[model samples]
Target: MTDTSTSSVPESTADATAAEPEATTAEETADGGTERPAADNKDLFRESEIAADYVEGLLDILDYDGDIDELTQGGRPVVEVVGARLQSLVGQRGATLEALQELTRLAVFRQTGTPSRLLLDVGGYRASRRKELAAVAKNAAEKVKQYGEAIKLDPMSAFERKCVHDVINALSGVESESEGVEPSRRIVVRPAS
Candidate 1:
């Protein structure tokens, strides 16, 4: 395990809203100017730290070894666990991993009194899944282009939708959108106008 502290964790532009005022409450300053406390972006970094510690404990308990990388995406911190033969951490259809992600988020929320959107990727499962989703997206784009009709895909997690969106957006003749809520939300590929 790396001895890096939370202070050393890298922050993306989206993660560090340091210049923004706290959204909790409005107050007057000594000069009679209305302002709020500095927003505690620390909570997000805390979330990643707490999540890392949790996953580390899990790995230790399971006698599994992995290198964890902490990062930020779209304003949320993420933890990626990389190791060999760690597919079980991903679970069947990623159900177990999703559940664990929620648990890790909850752990962060409990400590910071703020909800978190942390993403946890185990054993490069997400990278492989991204490739697969990209292929599905490309295929759907082809069908849409050929048929001149929209193609609705199976319900997918937000991650899958993002992968498809990226793929479709990169193509010359297709577009896509997420059309539902979590657990059943999916994407629709359509011919570009």
Candidate 2:
């Protein structure tokens, strides 16, 4: 799966769910799953703890403080930092946040020796932007169905394009593909092959 750092596919696995801090240590199951002290999944929370520690170090270096909440949602580690004046952390359509999330995940990978599915949110920007992009994707799908002409969205980050691709693919009459290169890459919706 593409690393859409600011995104969630919205299926909360039974193996993992959301939670706040104040955790109890856990051990691995015979099936290689981590058992949670709480009803929530421990593996995801474990990943989030690792991620939060990494982010907290960066925060200390930058002298920034916010509420860091680590939870496992959608079978992934989600770390949310919420506070004032952090929109710059999001960059233009969250490009900077995505890069930071990648870097942070790399930090986790170094520690665990396995790639992580970490979702980093600073501010509530991603939720808001996702709604806006869903609308855009819906509109584009309607256009594709109506005219049968190819429609290309403006250059978007990889995450944004993935959101668009999912929306278009779910519709009946059209399909989507990413074309071009980073910083100028985009999505194209067309008749299904």
Candidate 3:
């Protein structure tokens, strides 16, 4: 029901923005010199704007009521939809939400002619899932430490595996690795040698 744009640069952040052209430009340097665009670093706000518009249209089509907020986090564009009765958009284990995120990224790519790594969250699914995954990672790490043996976890989505890997990497006496192919990819936590 509401759309928020991150396109406008607040006057307060103007100085920081001027000092960091990489945050906006595709390739060109701050001094207008030549440089290949940072493939992982593009115009974050613009990406958010494009993704927000796309999600807003989707909401309208589904007759859904939600407040959409778009912004950049950790150098990646993020779109969050907040509203009651939005569980269906999240689907089972966020399958639908993941599909919708890819579609939104495609929409951004079509407009900007660049691939987008935009992340979409419906009803705080990702945030909650991250917490849950963190717990899972910690528990697995504990098991590996206690048993002093390698432990293979169930297959997980890329996002889930990434979350687990991040958490496991931070723990001592444990390391993690991914094996298998798509849809069957999983993480293995083992005691450090």
Candidate 4:
């Protein structure tokens, strides 16, 4: 495990907010994608700090040893916990991880008074799961294209479905959609008309 002392843990939320530099107006990139306003980035960073503190407290209460890192990713606050024996926090099929993420987002919202798209990851579960889901999406897309019929994937969480949809949407000859309700919602890949 890496030394937690050297991690970029935020000292305090106030310090984090106070240290933000003045931001200019959003600028368009060469690719036509607009950069987020610096103040918005600062707010996202603050959300991450608040979430990191909440996770640190939870880890302390649980007597768990892990190194937590907080950062902004894809325009949202992300907190990642890395260390040994952290699988319980991830739980089976990432159910516990999802619940923890929601709680962390709630913590950020309670402090910031705004909804947060905070993503909490434990033991790199999300990164690995994304790879797996991408493969599943590819396989489903291939089957749909080959058979010229819709292929229904097993029920998946919102995050998992999004991963699958992203992969499927990028490929040609096939499209994907979600169906059903929570805990049972699934994706269907079909040949594009």
Candidate 1, 90: how far from true, in Å?
0.3
| Alpha carbon lDDT at 94, candidate 1 | 64
Query: In order, how many clashes per candidate?
Result: 0, 0, 0, 0
lDDT of 1 by residue, 33-62 (tens): 233333355655677888998889889989
Ranking by TM-score: 4, 3, 2, 1
> Which candidate should be chosen as best, given TM-score against the real structure?
4
Using alpha carbons, what is the TM-score of model 2? 0.73
* Cα lDDT, all candidates: 0.64, 0.64, 0.68, 0.69
TM-score each candidate.
Answer: 0.70, 0.73, 0.78, 0.79
Cα lDDT over the full model 3: 0.68
Candidate 3, clashing residue pairs?
none
- For residues 1-193, write the lDDT of model 2, one tens digit per residue: 1221112322111212122122211121111124334434676687799999998898888787688999887667889999876777777656568767878888888887866767788897777866777888887777777777777666554445555666676788887765554444556677777
lDDT of 4 by residue, 88-155 (tens): 99877776887788788789889989767777899999899889888888877777777787876676
Query: TM-score of the candidate numbered 1?
Result: 0.70
Mind giving the per-residue lDDT tens digits that candidate 3 earns over 53-79? 999999999999999999887667889
- In terms of TM-score, which candidate is stronger, 2 or 3? 3
User: Backbone clash tally for model 1?
Assistant: 0
